[model samples]
Target: MKGFESEMIQRLRTSDGWKFFGVLPQANRGLAVTWWVLLLLRGILPALFAIVIGRLVGAVQRGQDVVGPLALVGAVYLPLQILAPLHRAIGANLGSQTAAWLYDRLVLACVRPPGMGHLENPKLTNDLTMARDFDLGISGPPMSISMDFIASGLVEMIVGLASAAILVGYAWWAPLLLAGGWLATHWLLRESAVWRDRNTEEVRDAQRHADYAYRLAVEPFAAKELRLFGLADWTVDRFRSMRSRLVELRFQATKLRERPVLWSLLIVLIANIVVLGSMASAAADGSLALDRLVTYASAAVTTGMIAFGGLSWALDCSAAPVAAVLRLKEAMEPAGALVLGRQPADGLPAREIRFRNLTFTYPGTDQPVLEGFDLTIPAGTSLAIVGQNGAGKTTLAKLLCRLYDPQSGGIEIDGVDLRTIDLDAWRSRVTAVFQDFIRFELPLRDNVAPGGAPDDFIQSALADAGAAGLADLDTVLARGYEGGTDLSGGQWQRVALARALCAVRLGAGLVLLDEPTAQLDVRGEAEIFERILAATRQTTTILISHRFSTVRHADRICVLEAGRVVELGTHDALMAAGGRYHTMFVLQASRFGTEDTEEEGVNYDVLT
Candidate 1:
């Protein structure tokens, strides 16, 4: 018995119903307190009005004055009418505030961590999706509208309970008979009604599928492809099918079962018949007065509190996201968490960055992307890494930027372990143009110097990147705005390179460029490479690219294969040694060599 009681208590505390109450205060304390007070008054006024009616009836029967009872009725009825709209107005404000609070918490959980592991974790997708779209009214009604329904539902339940308590004035058994019957409907038909648990995997999966199909249909990114492939009708059909499946699953979970519904109706019918019949018999026998009968009858009728309805549905939908946001606040912090260090990392890779016996695989993979990788890059020198796709070239840059720590071994700055350095400070000293760098739709100046720098400094960096006169500094990068324009692939690459150069001017000590000039032609790439080397002469630089034209300009070049360095030397030395680098360089150089020139001559003669 004790164990069962403890389990019930635990369930009650964690239930969405309880969480709904908890969210009220988080929205606004003063408004929540006032809303509650109004709700309580609104709930009890029905019983109070009933009692006043009985008093007026008794006064008429006794041939006494009816003025006092009439006055009492007006007083009680007036506030009962006024309280609802007032309560709803307060609820709207509270609802908006609650939505904002949840969003604030969700944003913090996503970005507060220094590492990005949690954002990539598949396990969190369901909850993350739920919290993100809950208030948008896609899955259900938005919180602002749902708040009114929720308040009405709670007030209805309260009215039933308060009305039932009034039955105690007649007979104790009368209150129990009425209240018990009404309350049983909740437990008996819970699974059949608005009480389905949306947290079930099957339901959430259906929702995800439906949401994906909806996005494909509505989002602009997919619109062009959808129309070009003649898949518009197919997209609609897919959306309809997914939604139909979701509706089917919801019905299976919550559809009313006939047996339970009938049982509940019978229970309520018997309770009402017995209680009212007893009151009728007492009145006929003159054992009960007319006024007493009137009061008891009203209280007995008011016990149909759950009949106001939608308490289960509205509360469930509104509170699910609140619970999810709270859970994520606890779960996400540790999911993407990194071990932070207190040591300052300013200007200390002053010597050399060393990777010693390093081996790393991604979070969920088995094969190591970088195995036993050892390299040393002295300060103020440039090293280019060349590898085929998936040879862990970009993975090396991610490690240097501390985006993910290696599973074994470690990187050292001079002699201090890299993980022991302050994460933010270390990141501040490093800048990179990643293969998938973000293109913020802001002003060009802000895009180039996102942390804010002097106009002259940003212009100089832009000039170095061959991006001068590409656009005005204050022009937005996206074409959606009035004074904005979009850039071609090559132009965007120059802007990205300019971003890295701007960082170099702002005290960054390490620069990592991963295929920074992939869109530029061979000659243009070589020119940009020379400019980058000149600007970063005093900083440690690492470049990752497959183009020999760019790698050949580095101070030393390293050739990687199968996560291992196969050759490391100056370009001429590698070419003279006739190793892997020489073969690749020769193959690329031959593409533009004698055969291509002769082919071009033949084409020119034909045109002439």
Candidate 2:
């Protein structure tokens, strides 16, 4: 909790180095004005009480009537006390609601991006933690640094001055006592800041430890491996160690904070004692009148220094997550793919899609994924691209879709450069069903028409994809909110294939197939090819597959090697030429005769 407070303080402090709750701060004017008014009232009301009470006592001592007036003053005090609380609540509530709204907008802004790229840096991660922790009540920085808090703190300080002035008039030591209260608060915050900065890197390590514990204990994906390897016990041990180390680091940071606060508090205690003693001496010396003494006591009660100190402690608890959340907002604010307003994809002059002399590399990768790559899908035709694994087949699909742009060269859809057209507009006309296709737990009809319309043609798509007998399509879709009844790999592929067809029916003119049938049995593969041939009969298609049987039917076949297209021809032409395509076909077709399936280092090459 102490560590969270430190983080929260850092968050509330401006990037430009101004403190959030600094005396004479430049915060929201209305909130500031409201606070000063409330403080004036709080300070004035208490002094009024002391003055009235003292007068009543003075009159009664003189044997004059005092009951009626004292009763009236007491009545006013009750409502005034209630108003102070109501005012604080109103301001705090207003500030909290505003903060929540800002947090939500920041989250949605980050979410608009195509990927969570902003989370790559430490500053952003730390800032988010600050924002999150601060939003909590008296527990965190958000609560402490909020507009209401700023108002309240300033109000309290002003009221403290009322008490300070009263003490200073009768005793020189009273000024020192009030100064000591501020000194304690100020020194405590400064020490906290120092420890906060010192432990930031360690806190990150602690965060990672916490994250690992969360994954081990809660995430479902790791449960299988953990259970299979008898690792649940070992993981529990690891979590315990990480948690213990994190707690120790937090404790050390907290101790650094506590020392300064304790020393400052000691100084304040001494200052108050000296002031109290001086006031007593002045009264005994006849310099202090009883009526005046009562007034000063009322003013002293007005300060609420004890409440301030307690509030400071409570504020830290809420500030940790609030600070984290704010930091997250800062990080989230600038990251993600920018989406411009929608554009119409129609009237593109050329129908062909071409990649010319394209060379590409992923960020953080040294080896080029695509080297001077060139490929073209002509207007209204099918093109088969065959490649060995890791030969950049899938990378080409990503580039084509503009999930990424190439490092050099460019892709042209028709004659217009891909860079010039609207991305979402271009993407809309193209559809893809990857090997790792999504199996949405939506209704069967909705899944087939996932990105398109749910219309009467749902039956046709399912029948085409070979899930025709899986029960009534609508009934199958309805059966499972429970992971959608768990489709077999082949069945899911068929569903994905149907989804692509529905996309075509809804006006998608081009489709990219990325190993769309890798999981299918031979019979299923045959059915898939027939479906593809039918779907692409009228639209352009770029087919990516390892099966020569699938590629042989395309109007054109292009072979890729080391990120370059090494061969392009009709399947029959390549076969007759007896080069790479012909050689690979013969080799792969020969695999059926082997008793064991060959993997990566296998020596079952037909040529060998």
Candidate 3:
């Protein structure tokens, strides 16, 4: 019994209904107030209705003029008739607005963490996925389902009390009998709710899989792969299998719920027979008038419907989302995590940036990607990182950009520890064009100046990135926009490059390019790199690429092997040492020579 009581208390405390109401006013104050007023009116309407019915019936039996009571009933009924539809419409609009507000908050919360650790956690990812599913306009946390439940429950209690008062005039035990049955029914419903909450986890997991499969089959990015790989039927079958499992679990839960519903119905039936029989007997004995019997009966029935239908249904529907919101809040930040510092990283690195004894590993992994890695990059000079796949080249760049902090050791900018600097301030001074850069389906100008740079800056950035011709086109970059045109892979790369350049033009001091020319042809790649180097001559640059041709142009080159720097020097010095960098460069040069020889009908292998 203590366990059950504890569970119930916890459930009530964690319920989204009240929490949602608490945040609703802050989300939209006027709408929340209006919603509350409408709820109050709705809550008391049933009792008011019972009173009007009793007055009208009593007046008729007493042979008094019934016009006043009948007119009052019409006035009450007319407004309720209008208010019901208006209430639904306003609730829907307010729910939509609140959903948008909640969604924005949820997104900001997910994005606010300084490191990528939370985003990568599988459990947190699942929670975020479930939270997103609950964020729909009608189904989301912003809705007043909980408030509605409170109001409806209040109405049920008020109506039940009024009915009990009317029954007390007949016999003092009459109210107790009715109240006992209502309490029993409410307990049964609460038990069902407890069972449903217990089983919701399994249902949510199935739903996540089903939603993922559906997206895989239909989303635009997956459409091409699905068709090419003939995975249409496979994806549909997977979706159907997961969806069927979800439905089966829900159906079983529904069956469990029906047991309590059946018990409630049986209790209601027995109570009705007993109440009506006593009233009829009293009416015949001249102890009760016919009008009073009618009023008491009406109130009794209304109280039962509000308790069983309104409160029970609200509890059943809102259990999951409320729990989801609570869990998300708890899991948003891991325990003992580093707090983001507020000390400003105002100026650019005046001397140099140093990576000292850096050792780091990805979350949920045993092996470190960078182990005791150390390097120094002079300010306002180009440094290129070259490595074979999985050698932690990109990881090094990510460390420098503060995307992930090292497990041990740290970075320093001009002698100050990176951890002590304000994260936003440090990021403001950096710009990067990654290999998998975003292709935002926006206007050309908007793409270059997402933070809104001037027209002259946008044009100059475009010219530097070799995309000046795109400026002449009046069409937007994506198809959904008015007069828009789709861009080729190479064109999109240039747009991304321009975005990075524009960031630099807007005061960013350091630019990191991670294979930005991977989409372009060999000659195009060389030309783009040349232009980038020329445009950012004064800016500090960190370039990560597989192409030795580009690495040779940088002031210094570092070859990473197994997360440790194996070689570091100027291009000519590295080439002279005949080390890993030299060997890799010779291999690439031979491959290019072989391709040239093939075009000329010569056997390069024989010549070698």
Q: Which residue pairs does candidate 3 place in steric collision?
A: none
The best candidate in terms of lDDT: 1
Residues 1-608, candidate 2, lDDT per residue (tens digit)? 99999998886674212322332223245654665566568655655676677777667766787787588678758857786776677566545554665467457655655434454444465455444433643123454245545555545655565556656656666665655665565556544445453236676567566556756877887999999999988888888888778777766665545555567667666666666666667678978777666766665555435335223332333333444554555555455353343446773323688889999776445688899988877877888888788888888887777666677898777766777777777777778988778766667777888655755677777777777766455544434465446677777888888888777777778888997877787556766777878866878888888876667778999988999999999998999999998889778866765533332212322322
TM-score of each: 0.90, 0.72, 0.84
2 or 3, which is superior by TM-score?
3
Deviating ranges (above 4 Å) for candidate 3: 1-11, 111-116, 133-169, 186-192, 195-201, 257-265, 312-347, 363-367, 388-390, 473-475, 570-608
Candidate with the larger lDDT of 1 and 2: 1
Comparison by lDDT, 1 against 3, better one: 1
Report the lDDT tens digits of candidate 1 across residue range 347-397: 967999999999988765689999999988888889999877898999899
Candidate 1 TM-score to native? 0.90
Q: Provide the overall lDDT of each model, using Cα atoms, as 2-decimal numbers.
A: 0.85, 0.65, 0.74
